[model samples]
Target: MNIIKFSAQFPVEKSCIEHFKAQRDACGVVCPKWGCVHPYWLQNKLCYECKQCHHRQSLRSGTVLENSKLPFMYWYAAMHLLTSTKKSYSAAELQRQLGHKRYQPIWEMVCKLRDVMGKRYNLYQLTDEVELDNAFIATLIAEEEKDKPLKRGIGSQRQPKAVVVNESSFVENPKPGKKPKRVNHLKMLVIEDLRADTISKTVNEHVNPKAELTTNDATPYSKLFEQVKSHHAQAIKKEDLPKTLPWVNIAIGNVKRLLLDVHHQLTNEYLQYYLNEFCYKFNRRYFGDA
Candidate 1:
């Protein structure tokens, strides 16, 4: 939603709390300890009481906001800004906007949200035709490597290997200036190495076994056929990437630019969280301001 709509909908902290409570209620609160789906809302305590074990859990007990002391409005506002924009706000920028005094809490909150984004996307597998490729995203050198001699060129800095896959469906009818395929869902996974087994494992987990796959004739993708029904691996030139593996290439380029533009220095530990936010927004691009 737009700023005006958001402001009108959640003008006060109570409104945000009520909306969150309604959403939690619709989803049904489960007792994390006992896995009890039914829970009674204790008005006085503002928590859910499990009838089965007489356990009381706060509203945010099992959610991303479990230990967060931030106001409900802050979270609602953050969600709105993150979803409503084409790009994302850095934790520092978000903290400035939220008027928060400390940086750690806001950063943690953003990272937690991004982590959940990855988890939510993990529930679904990509189907039909997909293009797979690997990207080396620049990252901050490890503590041990910080004092070591730097290598030349790309190797001078630490770059994390990421497996990028996107579902692309062929469009029978050609629109003027449009590509032959349209992208659906996309996934990016950071891996230790770009070995055949590593790439294969990522594909098997995220892509449906029945889906047809396409990739450049990279040696690491040699065993991709074992994971999917069809594997089309061909040598692709730089100019022909638009026709060969359009969406995956575009996604890789866009994400790299996004990270470079927003968070200049990245750590290997949190690289996946950054990727998760990009993929989450890309997947929901059609749902503008939702």
Candidate 2:
């Protein structure tokens, strides 16, 4: 939605007390100990008290907007801006758009909201026809460069690896020297190790066992299919060009662009967070006017 529409739908200083009250009461029971239930007092401007423990839990508690000193209208406006845009915005840009004089607070606020959005992402389940792959993420370090010998064996290598596992979905493939058409579907992961154990653990945690799996003919992924109902393998030649699934390629391409264009430099320590943010946005790419 545009700013005008968003403003109309959620006017500035519109009291959220009733909204919070409704959300609180939706639980149907007041059990403060479990952190879900509360009693709404209309006379107190919809202030709620925990029924079980009688503890006071504000409406923003357990929500993304919690602990924010910013006004509710600003928070709502920020959410609208972040969710409505396909292109990710830097904190500086957000600060400018919000017309906030202080950059640090707005930057921190955007990061926090991004964190909430990351946590709220609905990731794919490894149910059927999933793709598994890995990509390298290099960090720019300010040090003299030295030639490091390439290791021959995967088992002996020490380079950090990003293991991506995603579902198979159709995406539009654009032709060269023209606006790219979007097709194909896939998900991804950035991992520290490509070892069988590490990859297997991540898959087990994120993917459902009932789903079919696919990957390149890698030694580490050989036994992964055993744990699931079906596992398939495809081989790619080193000399051959990468024939990626359309949506997967687009997603990865966008991630590469973000790394180069937005962040510029990312370390292994925080690479996963960056990946999560990218994937969250990518998965929601089709949620128009959200």
Candidate 3:
């Protein structure tokens, strides 16, 4: 939803609380002790108490907001800001928008939300035709690993390796000058190494065994056909990314721009969180106004 609609829906703290209560009710909160689905809402305590077992569950107990001291409105507002934009707001930017007193809390909140986004997508496996590629993103070097100041962009030692995959389909029309293709769902994740076992394991984790994999003729991916339904590879240079794997290259470029324009620097420890946010919005790009 847009900022205007979000403000209208959650104008006060009570509104946010009510909305949370309704959501929890719909999900059917169960007592941890007795597995009782029918729980009593303790308005005074702002928690649900099981009638059968007397076990209590706070409103935020099972959610990302668990143990958070911020008001419910702050979470709703943060969600609005997150889902409403393409290149989502950075923690610093969100902190300013929230007008919160401390930067650490806001940063933690955003990271928590990012963590859940990754979990949400992990439930589904990429199927059908998929394009796979790898890219390097700038990251801060660890103190133990830091030897020299690394330059920005592609060949830097300070950059981290990431795998990019897009659920793609081909289409051709006689009226067209060239073959047209469509791509929507995308996934990006940080990888530790480029070994064949590492790449295969990562593929098996996120992609379905029935998927037809497509990639450039990388040495690690050469024998990947044995594990998947089918594999297609093209012998091409790195510069052919835009022309060969259009969607994935576009996503990689966007991520680079997002990091360069928003944050001052990214560390390897939290780079995956940012990728989660980007892919979450990217997968839901067509869900607007629905």
Worst 10-residue lDDT window for candidate 3 reads 172-181
TM-score versus the correct structure, for each prediction: 0.94, 0.74, 0.93
Q: Candidate 1 lDDT, tens digit per residue, 60-79?
A: 88788899999988898888
lDDT per residue as tens, model 3, 265-289: 6798899999999999989989995
Whole-model Cα lDDT per candidate?
0.90, 0.62, 0.85
lDDT of 1: 0.90
Candidate 2 residue 234 C-alpha distance from true site, Å:
3.1
- Clashes in predicted model 1: 1
lDDT order of candidates, top first: 1, 3, 2
lDDT at position 37, candidate 2: 44
Tens-place lDDT digits, model 2, residues 109-228: 776776665465534465555666777655553233224444544322333467666666433664665323233234456565677887787778777798777667877786787567
**Stronger candidate by lDDT (1 vs 2):** 1
Per-residue error at 19 for model 2, in Å?
4.6
Q: Which model is ahead, 1 or 2, in terms of TM-score?
A: 1
